[model samples]
Target: MTSAVLHSLGAARPYAGSRPLVLERIPVPAPRAGELLVKIERASLCHSDLSVVDGSRVRPLPMALGHEASGTVAAVGPGVPDVKDGDRVVMVFVPGCGDCRACDAGRPALCHRGAAANGSGDLLHGEAVLRTVDGERINHHLGVSAFSDYAVVARESAVVVDNDVPFDIAAMFGCAALTGIGAVLNSAKVSGGESVIVFGLGAVGLMAVMGAAQVAGTTVIAIDPLPEKQALAARCGARAAGAPADAEALVAEHAGDGVDVAIEAVGSARVMESCLGLLTRGGALVSVGLPHPDQVLSVQALQFAGMGKRLLGSYMGDANPARDIPAYLQMWRDGRLPVELLHTDTRPLAEINEGLDALADGRVVRRLFTLAP
Candidate 1:
């Protein structure tokens, strides 16, 4: 019976606004059927984690909350043939069952079983693998619980990556990179010469800028409430970056015809509505953010119909991990995606609360957490 001790930061009372995440020692169990034991190298802090922690999104309490992470396979369970020990990988929150209709149609992001498991806070088998030192059960958040030094995940949740990819950069692919570029390439299918505007200059929004840059002859504009983030957006190769009013003015300059595409990365319904106004006739608007239940996206029926505008709800950027991850990483390797532009530094895992605070306050675009080995 071999086992390892690992420390994790998780909120015992999320949304209660009490203590954030408790650093608790937990046992890393041997990988079971079709599972892998991953030694997490870098786990990035995402707004999704914040949503869960701040109670804006209801999740099982005492949950080891994290879905974005990069790690090396420490061990593989029976029936898992593709991934072996020492292989570098990125964790995907959505795992596609090959037999599912969604997977057969090449849209694994909508896999029914995977979504169910994530919603239930368990592995694919509908059980939790995490346990406290005293033997108390800990809920696995999104089948990852990557806030810990080690995590056991279903094999279907991992995408094996090249050895040369940095852990921090790979970690971003778990959500940020995939969702951002996926919105452009997959959901919007944005092509060359298409004018694009991105709202909310967070990691995902900035990545949308990078993705738009890959399209030839496309004019990319970025919008954000924060001036610092607007500047960051400019650095990411956006031709223009500023407030929502500025985006409106730019749209007006196009003769009241909006850009070819408008991407909404912020979950705010207000922001989502504002994006619709920035679209030209027949333009496509892609929303990748998770919206609050009470929040709604409303549009005037006649205006929407008259303009022939298209509204797309994109979850996880609608990217298939097996195919999209490598292609996005290739862009990262070619200096097109430019991982460094999104992540400027790393924070120790112990300082996770401060990182989350910075994120909540919009002090940082992306926070990379370096887990202790």
Candidate 2:
């Protein structure tokens, strides 16, 4: 199996020149207990993956990079009772053990064991299934590591999906669609007739726009510095889309007293503060983007009480893969959620470095890598 492995971090821009990610043919291990061996069909580049490449999110060296993906179950290990061979599955980055406090409370994103494994670049069971020709270990990225042709993932990380779903569309369900839509429907619970302002118009942010648009009478406002992305957001159901400088004017024109829900997907404390300012009294601000470790948000202490405002941190959109992925796919099938629009194009796995360059340059929304056999 050939996998995209990140050997070093903080590589110079134009990743094509730096060549931070290397393609290596490695051995695929058999799935162990509570694990499944997946034949990856499609994998997509995400800002999170770029973060690791650019040294923003540090991880162990020689790590296989990929999370958002869809694959077919080639084989299942012992204790994996539900999933079977030939089943199509969407890979979830956070693999909930189903026994943790957070999982018991229906919050898989907050699973302590999953977080620890991700931080350590191991799978849910604290194991790395990848190895080089010389036998050096390669860390798994968020338990999935779907950048390769095949991957061994914890059973908790694979959610069975209908086989008919296109692998490309199903791949997005693993991350962007799940997080973005979940933010609107589950985290913020934006209802009909409400107004929503989304900061940043990446795949996740744009999906937020799409989700908000699905509700009756909801007004969606999308903000992005890139004109192309803003245009894409408009097409994704944002009633109005523009640059950050024009956000206030758009809000004033479309939403009289600010929006009911303000979603921050830019991962910037500055942008999060701005989101808070765009919310109506008693409105909620959902922070879906992950900020840097040192970044801190400053706000007036009295606003929560005086204006009845609420600030929330949403990880993976508070999604439960077993429940939400199928529902999102169904919405896609019904034409209510046009997730296909999020795809910019597709490329081969060998061109991953070039793809990262496009992603870093904001040239595309979501570029997928076809890995099917």
Candidate 3:
């Protein structure tokens, strides 16, 4: 038996939006049917987690808040045959039933069953395995709360991988790398020699740059407020634009009309609108960031219609995790995706609050929370 101390969201609203998560020794329950008990190796702090902590995105109280991670299967539940104890895996936030309308159409990323489960903060089976020592139920976040020493996740929610793949890289692939790169290749279907621009140089934004590198002859332009991030984006195969004004200038300089594809990784309505403006006539704008629930975005209706432009929303980069996870890992192995460039720091799970603080200030590209045996 392993001792598991799970971090639970304790406050309805964090005191002044700081120190929101409370750590406790929650019961590490065994996986139920069609589930797996994973000993989390590393959990990457996500922007969505930040939103939840800051009270911007509200979920059930006392939920164990983490979704993106890499882990080793400690146990497998009945009916799960493909994986067993000691298997390494990277988790996926959404799980498809394989029978949903979206899944039937080969778009498992937007499966209604998974979306409904995430919305209600429940497992696909409508039960949470985690519990407090006092027998209180602890809500699981997106079916995989990796902030704990262990998490019980549906068998379909994670992909087993070779042990040689670094755990940190696998942890980020679950979210940042997958979503960012997926936006370019999967959502936008950016082709060879296409011009692309990404707004915001966060981890996901940088991943878009890395993803664009895969398409031969693709040109990547990056826009961000932070000079350091712009510099980083340049290193990741993008032409740096220090601000939106500079981005427009770069767009004209690189692509005579405008970029063939523009991506908005910044979760602001203003940024989304600006991305639409960055696209050339008949070009596509892919919005990957999760904006505020109440935020309403608008574009030039007549202009967009006349230009034959498309505004697309990419959830999880329109990724089919079962197919894309292996493809991304193989791409990394083949030396095409330079995901390691975004890695900044790794701290113990105890330092998650500090990690979130850095994320809040935009100080770190990506931080992985390591779990000790």
Candidate 4:
């Protein structure tokens, strides 16, 4: 398999910085029990991947860096049922261990021991599947590591999709699309006629716009610093798009009171605070952005008490990939959700860094890398 591996860590920077993403050839990974070997066709570049590449998040070095992707099943491990070779699939970032406590409670996103399972860089019993030319160990990020031309992911992580859905669109669903749309529908549960304000008009934010728009009579307000992003936000069904300087005014204008739901998709402390302030009484604030470890979100107790505002953190859009991925694809098919607009560009795996750079510079909304022709 050919993969872009991060071999070292340097200053924490965005993709536009000088850190190089190395492309190398290695042996294709084989599936273990309860795993699936997938031949990746399209892998989407996500802001999270950019964070990992920039060293904002702590990931093992010499790691294959990607989590959003769609591919075809090349092989299936023992005990995996129904799915077979040549089946179209999208990879899930969170591969829940079915018997874990969180899974039993129907919250696999918070599964105990699951993080250890995915983050340990080894399979079930401390076995590494990917190695470098010098026989050095290569860690797997998230569970999928779909940045490679091929990947071995747990069967639980591979969501089978309809044949009609294009691979590029399917790949975006693995992360950005799912995270944004799911955050609105699953996490915040924005209802019909509710007013929603989504901060940061990236792929995730745009998906949130589409999700809110799907709700009958819902008013969508999009906030972004860039005019291009604001324009794209309007196209994604936002009732109005405005700068951060105009967020409060925009919310008041649309909602008449304040927004019923405020979603913060950018990983900035200031934006989070702004989202919180934009919410009406008893409104919910859902945060989808993963801020740096050292950064803290400061909220005043008195303000929350007076405003009756609730703040919640969402991961992977509070998504249950097994259920949500298929539903989202169906919504896309029905034209209720516009998945095509979320994708801005596609490149080869060798240009992964450049893709990330485009994302960092806001040159692209959602960029996917075609791992194979």
* Most accurate candidate by lDDT: 2
TM-score of 2: 0.97
Per candidate, the number of residue pairs that clash is 2, 0, 0, 0
Q: Quote each prediction's TM-score.
A: 0.93, 0.97, 0.95, 0.95
Candidate 1 per-residue lDDT over residues 1-373, each given as its tens digit: 1122122334443222444776676677777999999988888888998887666677765688778999999999999988989999999989887768887888998888888888877898558888777888778788888877888999988999999999988999989988898899899999988899998888989988988889998889898889988888877888888898788887666425779899998888888788887788899889887777789767776656898889898888898999999998888788787778788578777777667778878888788887773
Write model 2 residue lDDT over 1-373, tens digit each, in one string. 8999999999998899999999889998889988999999999999999999888798888899999999999999998789989999999999998899999999998898999898887888657878898888999999988899999999999899888898989999999988999999999998989999999888999999999999999999999999999988888898999999999999999999788999999989999888888888999999998787789989887779999999988899999988998888888999999888898898889899999999888898899998643
Q: Each candidate's root-mean-square deviation in Å?
A: 3.3, 1.2, 2.4, 1.7
Better candidate number, 2 or 3, judged by TM-score: 2
lDDT tens string, model 4, 120-231?
Answer: 7654323567888778789887887888888888777789998888998898888887789988998899899899999988889999999899999999999999998898
Better of 2 and 3 by lDDT: 2
Better of 1 and 2 by TM-score: 2
After superposition, candidate 4 runs with Cα above 4 Å error: 11-19, 123-127
- For TM-score, candidate 1 versus 3, the one ahead is 3
Q: Cα miss at 192, model 2 (Å)?
A: 1.6
Q: Which ten contiguous residues of candidate 2 have the minimum total lDDT?
A: 121-130
Candidate 1 residues lying further than 4 Å off, grouped into runs, are 1-18, 254-256
Instruction: Check candidate 1 and list the clashing pairs.
Output: 10-21, 258-280
Better of 2 and 4 by lDDT: 2
By summed lDDT, the worst window of 10 consecutive residues in model 1 runs over 1-10
Q: lDDT for model 4, please.
A: 0.83
The collision pairs in model 2 are none
**lDDT agreement of model 1 with the native:** 0.82
